[model samples]
Target chain A: MNDVLIAVMMIVLTIITYKGATLVYQRFRRMYTAPIILSTVAIIIFLLVCHFSYETYMVGGKWIDHLLGPAVVALAYPLYQYRDILKKMVLPVLTGTFVGAVVGISSGLLLSKWTGFSELIIYSIVPKSVTTPVAMSIAESSGGVMSLAAVFVMIAGIGGVLIHPAVMRVARLQGQIGRGVGMGSASHAIGTATAMERDHLEGSVSTIAMVLSAVIVSILAPGLTLLLL
Target chain B: MSKAVTIILQIIGLYLIYLLGTAIQHTFNLFIPGSVIGLILLFLLLSLKLVSERWITEGAGFMITHLPFFFIPATVGVMGYAYVFKGKGILLIFIGLLSTGLVMGISGSVAQRLAGRREKAHE
Candidate 1:
């Protein structure tokens, strides 16, 4: 079927773009050619030139979305593998995630308010630190702009890609858990991807950290909002 | 376990995870997704020795390896909002990017220092 062909083409194109971006990032480490950034540029061009609607693209892309649930569930393994270290750092991890999420969310809200942002914009901007999926949901539930939240999430990811290395270098953070947790919590999936490129261990830790960040942020965001308001 | 039995177990495991996740969400009034709650529940159960990692290993492992691929759908969804972001798109995108970068840099350094203290504390 023609639809199947488009689906296949969609995947192949995604792979090529991904690979190309990775090659660019690796080839120019310090120069910062993050694959997501480049791939996004490629996708935008493709969509514009082809005159394809986003919904049409969704038909192919949804196949990938179905995997998100299973994949998140899978994160248990890496955390399990690092169980001993996890146990030792449980308190610190919890503390760090709590602080990070609270500060990130509250600051965004306060800054937006101080700058005379509209209520809708404030709500959309508040959950910028949470993962994209959750952030979108929170924005939708609160009647904020889900699309704007998504854009914010992407921005967050790109930010992770650009700043992580320089930050690591400056802080002298060579350890796996520390680097990974930082990336995961701050940037979510994008940070995790960056960590994976740096090393497998860092990737695993980053994955855990990102999940941790999402969970903590989700739990606290609503309550904090209610309390502050 | 046999293949059929393993498949059955996976279905059961998924249901149980969902149920457990809902319970946690209700109890704590957590604002997160149910599935993520499921993840945290599963992690805690394993850590507490309430569940066998062996039981959930196959399904969970399969999920983790393919996690990165899952972002494709969400990212593609961005096309829908292309209108709102048209004029101020560049500025908005840059702000989001810069905020995340600043957070990552600051948090990464701080976590590292605190974790180092934790490591020393255990000794």
Candidate 2:
């Protein structure tokens, strides 16, 4: 296939798959059917079946990936818009995510160590609760495989989103604020998307949590990785 | 201006911020990514009223709304890592689930308690 042709195909395929997944998500409104998970899974299977390498897919996928940076910068808009609410809820949101960040790293470290997973795996998962790009950086600084770290980050996001309801119910969390913080701090962007789907205000708060948790993990992960793992 | 031009310009504005952030990160040799630096810089600009919300609103809204879509390709990289996950796939999944649950439960409970307390205190 020509470069130009594959480029168009990859971009079109991603868009079509994403749009189809969005429709299914709207219809069923299930966690599993969410566009992030569903479309990624569908495309992965499609690629595997076609025997197209990830590098090949990236001929166009890279174009889409390039948008991630601007997307991250766009986050500042939401953060600024919600400044007043964030200020009011600062104590809870700050305290909750701070604790959550520490616990996220320590728990992953302990569990991975106990299970005899490789040190590389331990380093990869240490920052799993943060967003993908930041988590990869953290893992890299810690001598972990950046790609493996990204995989762990994705697992954490999807797993956190998947278990959100059950955990919320059992935890008996009442306010939307807490739920937002919980989702963002644990799951990062994926969780933030889920929260946004339900309520804009809650989602806004989650974005703050997501960003703050990312900062917190970035600051704390290296120290913890050295000390514990 | 038409909505299309407005959106395009806003995106360009955001892209400029992104580039500035990357340049700063490179200059400082910082561990943080350029995009994150851009986020913080943009936030500060917004907070200080140096950058108007209207400027980035349409562009940011579009980007934020479609944020999760951008993560799909990276997440799909899992397919190539079957060997790394081989026997320990379940274990890794377990660790992810357990840690996430713990983080969520704690953060949610903590925030709920404190916020509720503040409400009662005000009352």
Candidate 3:
């Protein structure tokens, strides 16, 4: 296939898969049916079954990837909408994000070291708590593999979405702000999406938390890697 | 503006912000992602009334709501690293899940305590 043709096909395929998965998620309302999880699984299966190479797939896939930058920037809309709440809870949100960033980075570094993973893996995992674009930059600057960082980030996000309700129940976490901050800071975008489904207040707070955690982790990840690694 | 024009303008505005972010990152040698810089820029623009929300609201809402769709391509790239998983995928999963749980627990508890204190103070 021509490169442009393949790229166009990939974009159409991606959107269809995502929309289809989203419908299933709405119908089932199950964690396993979450659009991100489902679309990734479905795409992977499609590729494997058709014997498509990752390179050929990415010729088109890269177009979607480029949009991720703009999508992230569009997050400012919610942040702008929720600015009043953000101003009111600035102290708690900042403190919570700072502490979460520290805990996430330190724990990731420690675990990777204990497992004797390479420096690259350690660097990649350090920024796993942040959203993908930020995490990729942090990983690159910190000498990690960007692709690996993206994978680790996806795992953290999916894991956070899956485990959050249970964690909330067990920990008895209260307050929409608390739940939002926890989910946003730990899981990034996916968790925030899930949070959005639960409540408007939670969703807005999650957006703030996601942005705040991204900024904090971006600043701290490299320094933490230098200090710990 | 028509819906199509609104979407186009919004995208152009966003792309411009992204470009500004890229410039700032290059100039300052900041570790921050350009998209994040763009986010901060957009936030400032919206807050200051420099950029009317109505112009971008429709498009931004659409993008944010479908945020997961954009991520599908990158997530699918995971298949490229089958060897890493084969080598110590379990270890990676263990660390990722463990850290996620720890982060959720710690942040939730801390934010809850702080929020509680604030409520009490307000009361």
TM, chain A, every candidate: 0.86, 0.93, 0.87
Best by TM-score: 2
TM-score of each: 0.78, 0.93, 0.90
Locate the minimum summed-lDDT window of 10 residues in model 1 chain A: A65-74
Return the TM-score for chain B, candidate 1: 0.74
**Which is better, 1 or 2, measured by lDDT?**
2
True contacts kept of 1: 0.48
TM-score of 1: 0.78
| Model 2: per-residue Cα lDDT over A1-229, one tens digit each | 9998998999999999999998998999887888888988999999999999998999988888887778778878877876776688888889999999999999999999999988888998899999887898888888889988888888888888788888999998667788989999999878887787777667777887888898899999889878996
DockQ winner between candidates 1 and 3: 3
Lowest lDDT 10-residue stretch of candidate 1 chain B: B61-70
**What are the per-model DockQ values?**
0.39, 0.71, 0.68
Model 3's chain A TM-score stands at: 0.87
Candidate 1: lDDT of A186? 78
lDDT of 3 by residue, B1-123 (tens): 678788877877787888898889889987667887888898998989999988788888777778788778777878887778775667898899999988988987787778876634432
Give the lowest summed-lDDT range of ten residues in model 2 chain B: B114-123
